[model samples]
Target: MTALAALVDFWDEEIDRWVSGHAGVSDRLQPWFESYRGRGHGEVRLDAFPEPYTGRLIGNSTPVVMLGLNPGAAVPRFQAPGGVFFEQLKTLRYSEWAATVPYASKEWESIAGPNRFYQNRFAFARRLLGEPNWSIANGVYFELYPYHSSGVNASMEPPGDVIREFVLDPIGDLDTQHVFAFGKPWFSVPARIGLPPGRVLSAKWEIPSREARIYSLPSGQDLIVMAQNGYAGPPGAGDTEALARAIGLR
Candidate 1:
């Protein structure tokens, strides 16, 4: 099987194991699951416990890959199991579901309508690629950590195999042009995947001053890591053109 197909199978098996209440899987995900469950915050929910990856999986066409710290609580709170979103997730599997049900789909919007986190994150792709909507955009999103949580737990370390197979190997094998990775923690990803360290560059958005570090992979694709400010908070209005120029997209 191809690397991408293998990755899909990996996700399917993991999700199945998780949903079936596999003791090992439950034990593995307990920390992250309980972290949000025990927080005593009404807004924090864990109906959707683990999400390994989302968005359109890379295929024949070269896609822009967006990397994030982890799956946020924002999505699962709405798209819980038994809902249309989760139904699609179960039927199509993640990669196929993501491809079929783009973030712009009414099915997604109906459940998680106008989510600031997703909107802000996808804004970079919409602006940089000049795609008017995320539905038509050619991209995929992966997380450094795959579990869902309201807040990032710096101490939580994903299994080494998960890191290698899910994140690093797919990244190395995919035919991608540019990878826009958000969060300071991800600066080490390129190096971990065998690329040299990246050089940091700063970009000023409407909110805070954000940094975009650029790395060139051996395959000649560029990996641009940015501060988590814009995506985690509000949309960085007018960041497109300037960011495009800074990252050599313009």
Candidate 2:
């Protein structure tokens, strides 16, 4: 089936389960989920709330490989400023969501927090992936498009083994290679397998190995992979061109 259809089916089946299990959700949220027909911003923040995550994931196309991470509070809500209808939904709080999420007067703060996260993540990814100019031509920003998760719940820390069994393994079979690891916590399994933090892996975590090389930010400094491979020094003018070439995007 098409990507959108698959998303719809997945969300319909799974999101309700999450809502039923989470105590914070309220009856009021049911309407928002039922009525939500993909308005406002396209990106969905995967915090503890089941509604938004399920809604977005089931609605939007699957990202390359979701960059696994603990849920982020800075994730953008629809009430962000600068866009039309900005602050439109602020006065009312969605019962199924966290009180900390943007509502009414909190619009400014919500917009600011997640804006930075989105921008920084976008900028960093473009720079790292050698797509510095991707946004320039489009008259828009370069964003890390495919990252996914259950949302920002550090408390529900899934062990690497559990993550492997459930989330990562199922999606690993897809054509997409590369599961970018944001940090050490998410890097455990990928690192153990010698795959780069952001590259693809086999459906089973026990595949032999591949040439996935991990790197640090700004300058791909230090030993990214355990193997003392060459250090990626700070980017010089020529380095930009070289990195773009490395990713075959230039």
Candidate 3:
């Protein structure tokens, strides 16, 4: 079978298993399944939790940069802007994206909406062009809090094998142009998945009035790292612009 068919089969079987694990799940889940299946283009796919994901994040387009965060159910872990986004390019499987993982709106609602990370990135894109039309590698699999992949939480780490089993295996064969890690917390996960080695930049783009030199890397790969420290600047904040300017894109 083709990869798409295999993905669908695997997703359906996995959902069935998850549904069977709970009482009265079939009754609760059938309606959702029907609704998703009814959509043409197979546009809708089932998240690991078997939730309805309307975003078309699985195709053959590669991402320019990737953003990641620790898995928590408190905030929006996977929110992309509207309009002709990129293709899924590849797929990754992790239990945190599944329904079995505990999710709550408390953290999900806290940040990442109109004025949070989503808007921040949107603004950055707008500044580059007039409108913001881009995709982000938002579906993150927390190292420790695998189930809570939406909000913020504190944990040392989880085993590497768990990460490999759920996330790494899925996107192992995918290709991407560049990987932009959002913060230090997630700097290591993308590389761990064998995507690319995204380099860390500085967050000192504040009003320093000092001439900060733009250090260019030898390779033209254009990998970058930024922090989401609530700064009222750019997506990567000063760091993002610095990288952009360094790459001569700004």
Candidate 4:
């Protein structure tokens, strides 16, 4: 199997282990699971929730990538394990799954609205790669922690081996030219991985006036990380476009 295929298999096995309640799995996920469990009735079973595994590989590498903290919470009915949505994830057919439209189904639309989160989040990529080329098939969207959570769990920390193997190892092979990481929490990841400290750029025009940091990877690529307050909402078109230009994305 190809390296990307093996990575997919790794994700599949990890998710399966989590859902099956296997030993050792809970240790990594316990804090978040316990937090969700505490909320009581009307809560979706953790197993029924979809795993975060969107993005395609072009012959084992991607030119661009996006990173996020974790998958946001959603109702189980929309992403049950045996359903079509989950099936797409299992097979890695993520063109529609990772598109700006996300799943491209009317049922999903009714439940999730227009997906402004992605539409807004992906604006920089759309500008850099053009609308047609800005997609998971062309790049990737990796979550530092792969599970779904309603809110940020300050107590949860992903295992070191998982980050080294599943994340950093794969990234090292990608030959990626650029990486865009959203949220402030991501600022610490590079440092933890032994990368040189990123340089913070001024973006005074941004609503709420957030700063963007740029890290030059050893592989000669750029990793641009941004943080925003929740109240300010996801980055808008102007915000992304200006940042893209600021970084010389052209």
Candidate 5:
């Protein structure tokens, strides 16, 4: 499918589940929530509800999907200032946004590029794989939370399962070789509501023997989950260098 079609499908499936109170995007937000008109002035603030995936899908084929908790508030050039609409926000496809950023766009064909809390992981990955073997140009980035969150503790849990179902299922539908899910689950299994909360498990929790933080979801697709915070070495869960060597599929 075309990237826009894939993006629309993702939004349709995910928005329906998360915004359970409403049938779909509120009529008032239809124009703004669906798409931003053009690149806006000032650094784009991606901190809005239901942010879209960022990064280009080479030939509409994204080999890797970097999963995180949510979009933190930022004044980065990678995004457009038109991101928010009546508290709701929309993000241009990352393939478009990355091209604008200085280095993220480097080697990667994006509208722009940027990151830090997110970049360290990529840098670490580059340390192991080097060049296009594992670059943003060959991957996509997204957070598990459908909405924005400056910190991990800010979001609620009820919608997490639905988020996981819509988002992860789509990635599974893709020919994705790896899905690096950063951070831990916010809720425990069989939450108070009796439903399993949405959670990305760390690799260490899956296998006691492996000194790494990467595991395979039931889909048979390799999913590299990190600690609640994506860190490497020491206080972090696993070393990206080791993960690079261990990622046999790539």
Candidate 6:
């Protein structure tokens, strides 16, 4: 099968096994505070608690890749956790220009509606092009930590194997032109991999972004590491400009 097909297979058939140890999580989500006690602040064993990679596989036509941190309350661990979204993925799996399976809103959300990140990413994309049409513009939208969670935090580095297989490998093969990692969590991979070993040119960029610099891989794809935190939390209310400026979309 193709790389994209392999990714889908991993999410569909292989991902749901995270709930094996728990009784009712398969039926309904078990709160992280209840079952897996320390997940929020501790290590997430990828081999045992494998969370499927969320987000749509909206084909490989677009030029850029927007990588997020991880899912929030909306995209529960299981993509088809027995609900309307599950049925959505069932239909979306066959089509190319669609697949908002993990989009929390609904299937065809990307095709039929405004995407989750489009409006958020406008802080910069807007300046590049007025009233940015984020719709299906990026080739792939995913997270570095694809493991499902209830807003939990993993270590600086997750299992290398998981990264190599699900993230790095797929990105290497995909039609990726530029990779924009949103937050510190998503940006850590580049350091661990030890690429160009340089600093960003922009001095005005904030903390995490101030530390981040752009690098290119052998695949001829540019990997941009931003130094700012993700567009999350209360402070994030003002993070739009910093994010845009940090990534040079400003």
- My TM-score estimates for the predictions, one after another, are 0.75, 0.38, 0.44, 0.72, 0.54, 0.62
Ranking by lDDT: 1, 4, 6, 5, 3, 2
Residue 125 in model 5: lDDT:
48
Estimate candidate 4's alpha-carbon lDDT, on a 0 to 1 scale. 0.58
Q: 1-250 in candidate 2: lDDT tens per residue?
A: 6433443344444444443443232453333222212223323343333322211222123332224232333223442232312233233223222222222224545555444433443454466455665331111111111222323223223344434333444343333333343333343545443444553321221212212344432223212211112311122334334433544445
Predicted structure 1: lDDT: 0.62
Which regions of candidate 2 are displaced past 4 Å? Answer: 1-14, 17-66, 74-114, 128-157, 173-175, 191-250
Residue clash pairs of candidate 4:
none
Worst 10 residues of 4 by lDDT: 35-44
Q: What is the C-alpha RMSD of each candidate to the true structure, in Å?
A: 4.1, 13.1, 12.7, 4.7, 9.3, 7.0
Select the stronger candidate by lDDT from 2 and 3.
Answer: 3
State, as a TM-score between 0 and 1, how close model 4 is to the true structure: 0.72
Question: Candidate 5 — worst ten consecutive residues by lDDT sum?
Answer: 35-44
On lDDT, the leading prediction is 1
Candidate 3, backbone clash total: 19
- Residues 146-192, model 3: lDDT tens digits: 22233333332333443344333333323433334454444444444
Across 126-208, the per-residue lDDT of candidate 6 in tens digits comes to: 43333455553443556655434445454445544555566666676677566666666645566566555655645443345
For candidate 6, report its TM-score.
Answer: 0.62
- lDDT, model 2: 0.33
lDDT of each: 0.62, 0.33, 0.35, 0.58, 0.44, 0.48
Q: Give the candidate number with the greatest TM-score.
A: 1
Candidate 3 global TM-score: 0.44
**What does candidate 5 score on TM?**
0.54
- Candidate 4 stretches greater than 4 Å from native: 1-5, 15-45, 58-63, 81-84, 87-102, 130-139, 153-156, 159-161, 231-234
Tens digit of per-residue lDDT, candidate 4, span 74-171: 55665555654555555543433443234335766777666655555555566665475555345466776665556663533454455555555566
For candidate 2, report its TM-score: 0.38
